[model samples]
Structures are given as C-alpha cells and as structure tokens.
Target chain A: MSPPAALRAAGLVKSYRRGRAVDGVDLTVALGERVALLGPNGAGKTTTLLMCLGAVTPDAGTVEILGHRLPRERSHALARVGFTAGYLPLPERMRVVEYLRLYARLAGLRRPDVAARAALDRFGVSHLARAMGTELSSGQKTLVGIAKAVLHRPALLVLDEPTASLDPDVALRVRTGLREISAELGTALLVTSHNMVEVERLCERVVFLSAGQVVANGTPAQIIDRYGHDDLEGVFLHLS
Target chain B: MPTIEVYHGAAASFWRVMAIARRHAYVLQRSPHRLFDIIVWPVVDVILFGTIGVFAAGRLGGAGQVALYLLVGVVLWHVVYQAQISLATGFLEETWSRTVLSLLVTPMREWEYVAGVALFGLVKLLGGVGAVALIAWAAYAFKITTLGWGLIPVAALLLAVGWAIALFVIGLVLRFGSGAEALAWGILFVVMPLSGTFYPVSALPAVLRPIGTLLPTTHAFAAGRAFAQGAATPWHELGLAAAGTAVMLALGFGYVVWMLRVFRARGFVTRYS
Candidate 1:
C-alpha cells in the first residue's frame, strides 16, 4: 500500500473583512516527501500553512496531518508534527537546553533531557546550550528553533522562512543540516520560502500559490519549463 | 500531514503539564529579579500595611484585634491579587517571548496550559502567603492560621475569585495583545476599593454598596474580619462569597474560552508569533 500523505489540506478558506486571505486552497505532501510552497506577499501561503498546522482554523475546509483531522484532532496530529518559523521568538530568559527540554517534554518524549541533548548535538549547537535565548544571534536562534522542532523526531516538519535572516554561510549550513537531518529521519518536510535557491536545493516539488490559489504545482524544472524560464526564480516571478 | 501515531498517553499528558510548569520555573530561575520581586513585594506590603494597622488599630480597638484583622486582610488580599497577576503574566510572558505559536503547535491542550500556569501561580501564592504569615506572627503576634481550619474554605473561595480575574485578564491580553497588559496589575485595584478590604461593605456609598456586596472579596474580608474578632465565622458571608465566586468563574472562563476560539479561528495565533 502507498504511504499515507504527510499533509492533506482540502478546500481551505480563510477571510478577513479586508479580503480573503486564503480562498478554496487544496494542498498535500506525501510521507517523507519534501515540498516547497511559494508565493508573493498576500498570496496566502502562510495562512494555508497555518491551517495545515491547525494553528489557524479554516473558514471552510479540511486539513489532515499524519492522518489526524485538523482543529478537532490537532492535538493528536501535532504530536508527531513539528513546526518552525524564523520570525517566531523563543523565551529570552531561558537557556537553550532548558527551552529545548521544555519542548521535548511537551512533545511527550520519554527522556526529554536525553532527546534535548541529542537534538543540540545534531544541530551542532551543544556548545551554546547554556546560552540564554536573548544572547543568541538571529542565525543561532534559527538553528535552536529548528533543533527544538525536531527534538521529538516529528514525522511531519513544517518550516516557514527557516533561514530568512541568516547570512549566506549560515543559510548554506542550515540547508545542509536540514537535508541531512530529514534524510536520516525520513521526515516529510513542507517549507515556505521566497528564497528560490533554498527551495531549489531542498524541495523536489514546488506549489506556487497566487491570490490564495494554487497557480502551479510540479517539479522545479517542470515549473521553469511551464513558465518558459531558465530557473526556478524566473518561474516564481512569473507565477507570483 | 500524515496521521502519525505518536500519542502522548495520559501519563505523558501529566508530565506535559508539569513541563509547562517547569518551563515557567526555569524562566523564573534565570531571572532572579523576577523571583526577588515576587518575594520582596509582599514582605514590603506587610511591613507598610502592618505599621499602619498598628496605628489604625489604636483608634478602632485593642492591638491584638487590630493586628489579626489587618494581618488577615493583607494576607488574603495578596492571595487574590497575586493569583490573578501570576496567571495573567504567564499568558503575557508567552506573548512577550513570541512563544505562543511554538506552544500551541505541540500536543499540549489549552487546559494543560491553563492548569500549568495556574500551578505556577499557586507556587507564587504559596511564597507570598508564607512570607506574610511569617512576618505576621513574628512581628505582630497575629497568627494567620488561627482563622481556624475554616480558613481553607475562605482561601479557596478567594483563589476562585483570583482565577476569575486572571481569566478576564487573559481574555483581554488575547483580544487586545500586549497593549492591555496593564490590566493585569490595574484590574485588582479597580475592585479593591469596593471590595471592603479595610472597611465594612455598609461604609460604601449606597450606589457602590451593591457592587461591593457582589464582589467575593467584600464577603471574604467580612468573614475574615469576623473570624479575627473571635466572633462566629460569618457563614452567611462565606456562602455569598462562594456564590459570587461561581459567577466570576463562569464569566471569566466563558469569556476566555470564547475569545480563544475566536482568536484561533481568525488566525491571530501568528500575530505574536
């Protein structure tokens, strides 16, 4: 039998008085598959991602993560799903290890401290485990945030602009680390980013969202060909 | 997302609750200033209030009567005030750190978060109450424990009021964001004057009398004062306080749960995240 989909969102819709933020969107990621969600500002990419994570309730539609339905069974779904966003901040007063341990425990790890230690090691951040969250640079925080998300070895991992603020060197390192980690764990990855280079490097398939609708979905090369462009960035600009 | 079977069983759920409490405790540990503030504030309040209580008691009644009265009022009021602030601040802390999104993504339920924060507040309540009780006995010869075993019910009722106020504050913070943070500290004071903490409910203006009578604090302090004076524990006032607590709990819990659902539906989860 085919593996269950990592994420499945159907006819999702969300609206504000100003306008619809996400409108009748459907998306899916298969088990162990890596996918990228691409869109311009106001294209509702983030809103869709939020719905998949069950953080935002859809106005209309269904989302199933790892087979559990959204909003209703979010708690069950979230147990094996992890999320990280570059913009989400960690507690300033907590040490890195302390923060990670808290999340590990919340994720229901049997030995949270051990899992936290291993995550820190996997991310090569064990050296900074004692540092306070506020003391870390944006790049370091991103690394720690990613480490926290993966501590429980979640089956489905969602990342929003994971390396948005990192320098080229750090971003490259993050990309390499994520690739290695995902491969080792066989975790399905759903990522949203404007960095076409990062998307091209990490995601085999891309879903282009425009005005809260999926305008394009295919391999990077296929999208490039469809847009009559030489690269993924050209296709992104064309669709967005 | 693939429906992965990764259930954190009932046993683990309990641990998750403790983990939330542990998270707050670690934050407190890292910030000695926060711990110091919680400990020092109540002690200072006792010293300041106790001195005034001494002078005020000379005018109203015997020293012993005044000390017990003042001590009970001060201690119980802190219990209510600190409990509300502690719970409200727990929510605010998550907002300030932009960690609410991180928290919501886990298997942790809203009730788990509430219970954990409430537990943390209970710890603070103990610290504040302990320090005040010690000072009351050491300095004023007034034993707070002497309010009889009935003090347990009184304290529980007062804490219920605190939890209600805390839930209201949580609703405000969730709805209005950090801008309404001042309500955490300001809310208790708004009701304090009408609460009949230092005076009888009848002393208030006629229009304010009904409002005072409705507040659980007013009834709590009345019963506490009566107990201090070696009078019959005011069972009627205690009953009124319990009824009032029920109302506040309903309103507070109802408002918070409703606002949270609206917030989640509106995708406000990422507002701070």
Candidate 2:
C-alpha cells in the first residue's frame, strides 16, 4: 500500500575481537524524513551507518534499503542511496568535477556531467569543480563532498559529520540545500553530526546511540521534554 | 537540467562500470607517475633489455634466433608484470587517496569495480607492452610474430596468471590493510622465477623445479620456446598451462571476495585513512 521506509535496519549487530561494535541496534527512517544518528566517539555511529549502506555487513541484522535487502540486493538498494563522510577524503589525484562525475555516474545518472555541475552550483561551489583534491581547504573539501553526495538525488542520503568543517554561514547554506532536496525530491536524510543546534535545525528526529545501542530516539522536542533538558545539547550531554 | 532517470538493469550497470574506467582514465591522463608507470618505464625497460638481448645473441655466434628468444621472453614478462600491477595499483590508489569507502557506497558492485579496473588494466598496459614489442623488433630485429599460432596461448596464459596475481595481491590488501601493501608490488617477483619467463623449469633448482612446473606461465613459456625452435605445438604443456590458469583464476577471485567480506565484517570498509 504505502511506500516502504527509505531505510529499515533491525537488530543490527556487529562484533570484532574488541567486542561488539554494534549491539542489536534497530532504526527506521520514513521517506523524505530527516533523522540524525548522534553518538560520542567509539559509540558505533559510523559502523551503524556503514551497515545501513551495506558497506559493513552486520553479524546479525536485516537492512532493507528502499525495500531491497542489503548485501543480497545491494546494487539495487545502494543505487538509490548516497553516502558521504568528512573522514572519508576525496581522491587526491582527481579534480572535483571528475570526482563528482564519477559518483554521479556510479549513482546511475545519465547526464552525470550536467548533474555534477548542477550539484556544485546548488551548494554555491561551482568554482571549486576544477580544484584538485589536495588544493581544497578542509571546509571546502567537506562542501564538495556534500555536493557529490547529493548529485544523484538519492532516495536516502547519509551524511557523517558532513558539515563539521564548514563556516556557520556555509553550513547554513548546505543545510538549506539538504532540506530542499528532501522536500522537493523526497530524499530522506539520515545524518550524524556533533553540532546539536544544527541537528535541531535540520533533522526532524534524533537518535542517540550510546555503547552501540539506541539510548534515545524521538522528535527533538519530544526527546528534550522527556529528558527534561534545555536543548538537544543538554540531552546529548546527559547521555554522554 | 534534463530529467535524469534513475537507471536499472544491465545497461545502467555497464555505464556505472564505465564510470569507474573513466575515473581511472582521467587519473592516468593527469598523473605523471601513472603515465610513467604505464608508458615511459616500459619503454626504458624495453631499451635496456633489448640491448642485452642483442648482445647475448651476438655472443652466441650471431645466432639471431637466440636474440628472438630472449627478446620475446623479455617482452612477455613485461606485459604480464604490467598487467598484474595495473589491477593491484589501481586498487591501492583508492586506499592511498582514502576514497575506498566513498566508492563502496555507490550502486556499483564490488565485482563491477574490479571488472572496470581490470578492463582498464588491459588498456593501461597495451601501449607499454606494444611499445616494448616494437622496441624488441626495431632494436633486436626479433619479431614476436615469429612464434606463429603459439603466441596466442602464451599471451593468454601469461595474462591469466597476471590477473591471478592481482587478485591475490588485492586479497592481501583487503585482509591486512596498508601493512600488506608491499605484496601488491612485490608478489609477482616471488612468482617470477617459478614462472620461468626466460629459462626452462628444468633449469631451476630441484626444490623450485617442482614449484615452477606447477605454474601455468611456466608451461606457457616452455610451449613458446618450442614454437621458437620450430618444434610442433607442445600440446601437453599447453594443456597443463590452460588447466593451471583455470584453477588459479577460481582461487584468486574466490579469495578476494572472501577477504572483502572479512573487511566489511571488521568494519574496515569506511575506516579509510
């Protein structure tokens, strides 16, 4: 009847010799809904994100992306999912345009060059397209990474500390673009960031992961009220 | 902007693989080191080795057949080396650039990435191998065409083993990260003597002869020598070479795929640095 959620990850678990990295974590994001996965360092936020994207296969769990089972139908699922992280750097040898075009084509865009340029323009960084990967400032690199992530208009867009390096104004601009994509293209946004205020501004829901488990999940207002916190930052501090 | 349709089926996958190739093509075009690795270095190798081959032939009472044998062997070895290095280095480039996670996130399958780069590997070495072949002829007057129909199997067997080495190196990288990076560049040298590129398996030490004979490239080279000597096609050796290639290929592809699973399970896929 209704379209399946953009992402549905249930009882996702992954372990290493160091012990369990993700412990039976479950998450769901509706189509076009904006959600944030927030956690402290070593809290397994990135691991959960990777599992959702099929980059990391969980030892125990089922991840259905855009209604397609992960690893089995990864090609079908990931075709509609785009992911980016500031920690995952761009190729040093590639120009920004070429880098964006590569991801665009990989996402199945027929006119990848046009889409790449448009994405850059959307983020007001069209001039950086010719810049070599090493030449970009940290903030500029993150901006280009976001541009690359959104170029394909993926059904579910995942970002990891995406705007960590951007100036406030640039961050606001990028956030606005993200909102526009979700509204116009129904591109569900699943993001992880430390900027609590920006998270409040951008995401409709917040998921707090602590020690590889969901400690809290609800709307920002609901979570704040339930935790009796002044803001999302207070709740995050309490969780930590 | 034109409406960009979300693609499906084989056609979309084909283009996605091409995008992988296109990215590599751009890197090759822009990076001086890559261009040198694929082109200039091979030319220099050809010149240096071709000269030695010519001197050796001269030393053998002006017997040009010896020159042809040495020259052909040199050319084939370089071709296989270039072929093997292309795939391994193409993969290592992603790790070096810290972009493996970004790559894995897309719709492109792992096999597609390997296939695209492997195909590019062919393109990358063609110019270099061709250049060496030409130099072997121009400097030594020894044409590879002299090997006749036998050349096809020799080249195919060598390339198969080359691809096998690449898969093995890639598996090592996926399993051990950059710590095993040396394997990507150096594994083939370990396989070189066992392959008998310039010498017969019988010439190896007894301990190595057994290992040498186990290699497809060894048999391939032995068959090539028979052709050079105007002997009939060495069907027995040729058969052994083809069968060995089949087994190595299966093991290679299987091992890499397994290593990828291990990598993903360890959550190292996106931990790229």
Candidate 3:
C-alpha cells in the first residue's frame, strides 16, 4: 500500500454571484513534495488554497489534508497544516513574539513560547521578536509571518505569494531559507507565486493554473521542454 | 455526509476559550482606550444620571427615588450594553487586523472561538458593572447589593440578552462584511429607549408598552425597581425575563451558525482580499 498524500482535493467547485471562482479542480501533493502553483490574477489560486486549508468550504467538492476530510474533520486537518500569505496580515497591535506565540498555542503546541522562539531563531528574526507587528517593514512582516506559519512544524506548509513585495535581496534570502527549512523538516510545500525565478529556484514540480483550471503540471525542466520555452516564466506566459 | 470529529472534549474546549479570552485581556491591558470604554464609560454614565436624579429630587414630586432608580438602570444596562459591544468588537477586531483567516485555519472550532469571545466580553462586563456599583455606593451612599442575591440571576439574564445581540451583530457582519460594523455599537442604543431604563414600562406610550414588555431589559428593570422598593423577590418578572432571554439566545445562536455557514459557502470566511 502507498503512504497517504499530504493533500488530496477532488472536483472542487466554488462560485460567487460574481462568477465561478474555482471549477471542477482536482489537486494532490505527495508527502515531502514541493510544488509551485502559478496563475495569473483572478485564476482562483487563493480560492483553491483556502478550500484545501479548510478556511473556505467548497460548494461541491471533497478535500483531505494529512488524511482528514475538510470542513468535517477540519480541526484535525488544520492541526497539521500551516499557511502564510502576503494578503493575510497579522494583527498590528501584537508584538512579533506575542503573535507567533498565539499561533503556536492555537496550533496546540505544549510550550508555545519555545516553539515561537525556535521559529524566530530559524528565520533569523529573533532580534525583532519584541517589536510591534505594525513597526515592521514589508520584508520584516513576511519574515515574521513565515516564522509564525512554521512555528508548529506543520506537515503541509502552504504559501501564497510569500515573497511578494520584498526587496530582491531579502526575497532571495527568504526563498533560500524556506527551501532549506522544507528540505530539513521533510515538509510538503504547496506554494503559489507570480515570480517565476522563485518558482524555478524553490520548486521541484510546477502546476500552472488558468481560468479556474489546471492547465499544466510537471517539473520545471519538463514544463520548459514541453512548452518549447527557455525558462519557467516563458512557460507561465504561454499557459496563463 | 461527512461527520465532524471533535478533537477536544469539554475540558480542552474550555482552555481554548480561555486562550481567546486571554488574548483580549492582553489587548485591554495594552490599550487604555479599550479599558476606559469597558470601565470608565459606564461609571461616568451612572454619575451623570445619578447627579440629575439628585437635582430633580429637590424640584419635583417622586424625584427622590430617581437617583437610585437611574443608578440601578445605568449599572444594570451596562451589563448588557457592554457585553454586546465588547463581544461584537472582539470579532470585528479580527477582521480589521486581517487575522480572521489565520484564526480560522487553526484547530479551534467555530463554537469554541465564539464562546471564547463571549466569555471575555462577559468578564469585561462584570468588571465594568462592579466598578459602577462600587462608585454608586461609595459616592452616593446607594447600595445596588440591596437588590440582594436576586441581582445575580438578573445580571445573568441581562448578560444573556447582551450575548444574543452580540451574536446577531456578528452574524450580520459576517454576512455583509465589515461594512456593517456600526451595528455593534448602534444596535444596542436602538433598544435602549424602549428598554425603559430610566422610566417604568408603564410610562411608555400604550403602543410602545407591548414592545417594551418583550425586551429582556424591560423585565429586568421592572424587577430591579420592585427590588429597590423592597420586594422580597420579583420571581414573576425574573421568570418572564429568563424566558425572553432564552428565546433571544436561541435566535442569536441560530443566526450566528447560519451566517457562518453562509460565510464558508460564499468564501467570506478566510478572504484577506
């Protein structure tokens, strides 16, 4: 028998009166696999991620994360899943350490401070622990956000444009640190990014989404080869 | 249909609720304005009305009882008003901070989260009411405790009414987004005039009297006035108020649950955009 996949989503459909956000989508990420989700704006990347995390209930679909069904067994499923997004900011009134500790506790860590500190140290943001969340620069906020996301060492870590708005140098550092952490912890990573460079650098496999559907799925090299393109960015343009 | 597997039993659920309460306490401890709103505003309202009652006693008939009457009404009304405000704003705060998505992605269930907010709001309400009662006694020589052990049940029923209103506001905000946040502070005041806080329910116009009787605060204040006049216990009024509160609570919880389902289905539960 095979080991259970970290994430399994099938026939996922979500629609607002505005229009269909996600339509008949199926996705899976193997344990310890790092996959990039690429799509243009309004392509349902955020909607799909929310459904997989059990943050949003799909109108018609099924999702299981770490072997637990969504919405029904969401509590169990959420315990092993971590998520970070540039769009979802932390509370400004809370200090960095306080914010991280809250999430650690919510994730059910026994000693939230210890887990929080480890995440801070790992992300090289330990010195900023006492600073208010509002005081941080854009890059600093992303670093703190990622540290909070990984504090409990979730089995599946999801990121939506994690490096969006950072300076190039800081973005590179975060990309490198996240890649190293995922490899060290053997955590399955599902990342969505518009930056093809980050995708090519961090992901082993790539899934391109367009118009609420998965348009292409393969390794970066395979995608570039299949699409007759020189790089991942060229492939994204061709597909999206 | 898939069945939900609850991770925590009763005990663990309590701890999760406490964690949320603790988070609010941390915020209150840090922000003076939040603390002031919870503690100072009610006391000021009591003093303001209490002073008016004192002055009116010298000038008009039946005015001597005004001080105690208004004091009791303001103090008790805070129990419900503050509770509703605190809990509704507690939920709204998450949306403003854009942290609702992060919270929903956790292992905590919806009921646990709501319970936590309500508990914290209750605690804040207790402190505010206690402060007002203390000040009323120390400064004016009026004793709210004179209402005796019956005050406990009265306060509980009022808090339940507050919880119901807060839940209803939360449901509205969840359905309509933060654009409806004004409902948190505004809804309570809409009911205040009809609640007969300063006047007896009989003083309301005949047409308004029927609507007034349906309000939990109406029965609470009536019982409070009877207690002030030395009624041993206003079981009749308390019983009716309790029944009214139960209905409001059921409606509030139903609205909250239904709105939450709408939020989830409409993809409003975790959108940061």
User: lDDT per model, in order?
Assistant: 0.86, 0.86, 0.85
Q: Can you write out model 1's per-residue Cα lDDT over A1-240, one digit (the tens) per residue? A: 444688999999999778998889989898888999999989998899988988888999999887788778878899889899998887888989888988887887777778877877877788989999989999999999999988888889999999997899888878887887689888889999989999999998999999999899999989988889999989887877
Higher lDDT: candidate 2 or 3? 2
lDDT of 2 by residue, B252-272 (tens): 999999999899888777557
DockQ category of candidate 2? medium
The lDDT, on a scale of 0 to 1, for candidate 1 is: 0.86
Better of 1 and 2 by DockQ: 2
Best by DockQ: 2
Lowest-scoring 10 consecutive residues by lDDT in candidate 2 chain B? B62-71
Model 1's C-alpha root-mean-square deviation from the true structure amounts to 2.7
Q: After superposition, how far is residue A85 of candidate 1 from its true place, in Å?
A: 0.7
> In model 3 chain B, which range of ten residues has the least summed lDDT?
B1-10
Candidate 3 lDDT over A108-197, as tens digits, reads 665677888888887788999999887999999998989888887878999999999889988987888788778878889999999998
User: Clashes in model 1: which pairs?
Assistant: A6-B1, A6-B2, A7-B1, A8-B1, A65-B1, A66-B1, A66-B2, A66-B3, A67-B2, A67-B3
Output the worst ten-in-a-row residue range by lDDT, candidate 3 chain A.
Answer: A104-113
**TM-score of each prediction:** 0.95, 0.96, 0.95
Query: What i-RMS does every model get?
Result: 4.5, 1.6, 7.3
Q: Across residues A38-138, which tens digit of lDDT does each residue of candidate 2 receive?
A: 98988889889989988888999999998899889988898888788877777877899999988888888888888988899888899998999889988
- B1-273, model 1: which lDDT tens digit per residue? 212223357877887889889888887777777765477878887887787888877787566556666678888888897788789888888988888888888999888888899898899889888888888788877788678876888889888899999999999888877889999999988888899887788989999999998898899889888877778879999999999999999999999998888888888886787
Can you give the lDDT of residue A135 in candidate 1?
Answer: 91
Worst 10 residues of 1 chain A by lDDT: A1-10
